[model samples]
Target: MTEKLFSPYQFKSLQLQNRVVMAPMCQYSVTAKDGIPNDWHQVHYVSRAVGGTGLIIIEMTDVEPDGRITDQDLGIWSDDHIPAFAKLVDGMHAHGSKVAIQIAHAGRKAQDASQPVAPSVVTFPGEAYKEPRALTTEEVVAMVHKFAAGVRRAVQAGVDAIELHGAHGYLIHQFHSPLMNHREDVYGQELSRFGVDVIHAVKKEMPADMPLIMRISAIEYADGGYDIDHTLQVARAYQEAGVDIFHISSGGEGPSGQRKPGNYPGYQVPFARRFREELHVPVIAVGMLEDAALAQAVIGNEDADLVAIGRGMLRDPYWANHAALELGVSKEHAAIAEQYSRGY
Candidate 1:
């Protein structure tokens, strides 16, 4: 029987051999002290490609030095960083996996910066995160160009797609969250303005057929945070701005509250479904969806077009292969690495 999890998916000019995507997770292994991908990033991603991951989105790559959550995070601030990433992208392509890199600015969450920047001066609740200075309208405009520059570099490096990290309380989220953004300018009047501008700017640097994925926290889960309806409205704005796919995730906009999200499996599947049905767009479902059966069910039931396995992929670089085995996919469709075909 054909397994939905192992089936092919295509959108725009990007096509995946399976619905399994390796969610971007930070490695913090940049020993070079520069924002370049090193041996660790190469091995970590290539292993997933060999294991049959359909798509691998590199960790949150910052557009500026101070935009990183940690100093060790990967960056694309300059053309110098492209060659190292290009090698990894080429390797994944050789192994039958598509590659995308998530470009972002940490905003107030830049843990290592002496003073981070955000739409407002509000800092994340925890002491671990430092307070952030609000960005001037001019500065915000400048930052949009910086994000555009990052996209140009990614295209130059030949990535299959690009994802903007609009979730997890990053700079984009900060601008949209009412609790965090308290400006009186156009960005404040139009909550999605900053992100939307960034989207348009990034699009200008990309090929017409390339997919642009935006990951959004569909629910805030904190006290006084926006609800699903509110997030859906903002998502529409992003869709209008040229997002081709929505990767649904939740929380991280702020600290927990009485209305915190549940920690159960497939907790965010509903969010993904809503984006797909309501927004009329392809969606990637993530959040504790590690079980082979559950991942398959999510795609089979049409809850999401693709499933992103985070911790599961980290724990097992071959999670896709293992999932294929568990789902009883045919050997020909499994496409297990030739060197490791016997094990499968």
Candidate 2:
């Protein structure tokens, strides 16, 4: 049978040469602390593009300076940041890869922010984490605009798609989490309200044909954290608000309790499968799926529409190319860069 992992996939205007995605992993390499993409990021991502990855989701890029987890994290808060991002986007496109930016706010996870903010006054459990100040109702409204502005900048930078960081205890995740949000307002009453609003706002900034992807944690590992049932309800609201794809991930909220996250390959595939089945949308499954055959199995088994490789890609920029070789994809479909043809 033809390897599904090597097959092309498309959603809206974004088309991928294969079903492999380089998952958005924070680089934390912005030395200037100004949220600009530097040479380090350029080479890091472009190398993967050359390596034949179908879709490259740029790292967790913040909407504001203080919204970053650290000063080193990338940000798209300013129009000035567009040129640098556009350069990266252009580089990726030149190599036959479609690019997406994961727009996010670290919220209470902003370790360097003197006053990190969240849905309520809850503090993320960590020595480096601070007690986050609760955003006033007005600030919440403005925050949605900030998210939209970030998406606008990303669109201007020529990203093929947009992934709102709603997972891993980020700002959007904090708002939707019952444990993190304990306010008496509408946002607290309606957990998915904040995410839904951000989706609506960002959707307005995006081209009508551009797909809006939302990464969500299917289940939180923290004690008293939510389960898949609650997240499915939240995702339903996001879908209604206009999320075209769901990237299912898990557990960045806090420390694990009795329900610990699995530490094996394909462990999270079930969650991705569940989300796809329930939401009836294309979903990206991400975890420890580095093995070529395993990655191929994910697509062949219809467990996920796409598989995102994080640590695997970090370890090998040419992971997709190598995986293609391992899976015996034909040269015509393998997409190996001509410059590296001899090596392959």
Evaluate residue 249 in candidate 2 and report its C-alpha lDDT on the 0 to 100 scale: 98
Number of backbone collisions per candidate: 0, 0
Predicted candidate 1 versus true structure: per-residue lDDT over 145-172, tens digit per residue: 9999999999999899999999999999
Clashing pairs in 1: none
Off by over 4 Å in 1: 30-32
Find the 10 residues in a row with the least total lDDT in model 1.
Answer: 26-35
**Clashes in predicted model 1:** 0
How displaced is residue 90 in candidate 1, in Å? 0.8
Could you tell me the C-alpha RMSD of candidate 1 in Å?
Answer: 0.9
